[model samples]
Target: MLCLTGPTRAVTIDPPVLLAPMEGITDRIFRSLIAPHGGLGAAVSEFIRITVAPTPQRVCRRDLGPPIGVPVALQLMTPDDSHLAASVANAERAGAAWVDLNFGCPAPVVFSKCAGSALLAHPERIARIVATAAAATGLPVTAKMRAGISSPAHLRELVAAAAEAGAAAITLHARLRITSYDEPATWAWLAEARDALARCARPVPLIGNGGIETAADIVRMRAETGVDAVMVGRAALADPFIFRTAAGGPAPTVAEASAWALGYLDAIGSGSPKAKQLVRYWRCAGMLADPAQRQALLRGPTPAIAGFFTSLVPAGPAPPATRTSG
Candidate 1:
């Protein structure tokens, strides 16, 4: 277990497995499901775009409210430094424990606006943005970034600038802006980042992300990259029980897992049309271990789908059709 002192207080992070702030995947329903698993140090919400105007009070109340007692960080993506600063202040007022600047999302739509990975090309702008956001919120600030724009040469400079601008920590995805899910993650890049971070004059914890799929993988990544923590993105979707397994805690039975899903549906209400779509998208992201089971659950009628997931527990053998794909 490693304890890092944030702006507020020391946060004890064991095993240091974090749930990445995936846009569609890290909603309240999923955060509730994954928090009880025990190995997670922090859970970040999906990136909220900070616009020129302030976020509406009602929307902020609904979206930024605490999902759980665990340290919840609010992620914001914006090209405008002033706008991003306003969003960070709003997030703090709305009860965010930390503010995370997103500079790693590869979405073309986001990059076109000079946000996300596009910030990588201008390290000075990144420093200014980080400084503004960190100053706006007295809370600890962090940044999630790609390895580099197109080469490793610029990554160290970006990290150094973020740290200089008051970022409490940095999470490196260990891939370039153009590296998609199709390409395998290069673990060596994480090691190089670790070395670079160590050379920085100030102390900043480096968190490794990408291609971590299991408890074992977390251990391996920590050993290989020498990072303070491992952030699980697609893998958490594959098995929400990963943190629990890594902590040597009991894994939820299949029935228990299903019941957890049912609870989420109940809390959110499946009556909404979007609820059904959420079920399909969440399962497809790799939360279900069995492919056949996942398909069966998704294809079934609403009531059937709810019942199927509610009845599963952790004891069963892998569903025969289980195949790993992101």
Candidate 2:
């Protein structure tokens, strides 16, 4: 276990289980909703794309706001080393407890611009990027990378370079960029990455990602790979309580969980149509405790929906759905 002291208190993460910084998913609203569930050691900010143009203050405010009562790491994606370093500094100034370099995003638009997973093809560049960001931000710097470029050999090189770059930690998503969500994650590959990191003798922690859904899955992965941590992404969206379960805490009653979700929507405010739209999307995606209640909330104007979802608290788990994944 590593203990890091922040401005407010000391934060300890042992075999750290983290929340992935997924775009459009882990915003302030969601982070606040899930933080209280307990088990997660860190929540990463959504990837902030750094550009040659000057960053707007509001952009920083929106992305790098105050910590959500939990250790929050800011993530940045950019092809330029200097630009990323500057962005990391700005995030630190804005109150980021840690920094994450995103080299695992597989979006075609991102790769087309030579950002994100495209950097996987250049292990040397990946090392340079990690070195630059780590040097720029005195805080712990981590990197998230894909399994490899086109072959498993590439992943070995990637892990070696990241270790050489002084990364405080590294996470492998267990699949190549071209592999879509439909395919099962290659658990063996993740094991290989862990072994590679171990052989390097770097003291940095290694985290495994991809295909983890339940607490059982986490336990299995840790036992199999001997990694320092496991990251939960879509599974968290399905059930924020997974963290609690992983930590061996009592699961929140359905009503209690619903109330928490409502509180999150309330925090975001329902006064604006845009805010309402975001809430509605979250509701339809089964984020709310009660699906029927969420629909009824949307019956009136946007504000009404916000009010309803915010005030809802059913007595038990919502009706079983045809499909569920967390």
CA lDDT of each candidate?
A: 0.76, 0.74
Checking candidate 2 for backbone clashes, the offending pairs are: none
Error of 2 at 214 (Å): 1.3
Q: TM-score for each prediction? A: 0.84, 0.80
lDDT tens readout by residue for model 1, 88-148 = 7788788776878899988989899999999999889888988898777668888999988
Residue range with the least summed lDDT across 10 consecutive positions in model 2: 2-11
Q: 117 in model 1: Cα distance from truth in Å?
A: 0.9
Q: State the lDDT of candidate 2 residue by residue for 8-104, as single tens digits.
A: 3344665378888888778877887787768877788899888775344467668756666677878888876867767767777777777788898
Using TM-score as the measure, the top candidate is 1
Least lDDT summed over 10 consecutive residues: which range in candidate 1? Answer: 277-286
Cα misplacement distance, residue 38 of candidate 2 (Å): 1.4
Scored against the true structure, residue 79 in model 1 reaches a CA lDDT of 84
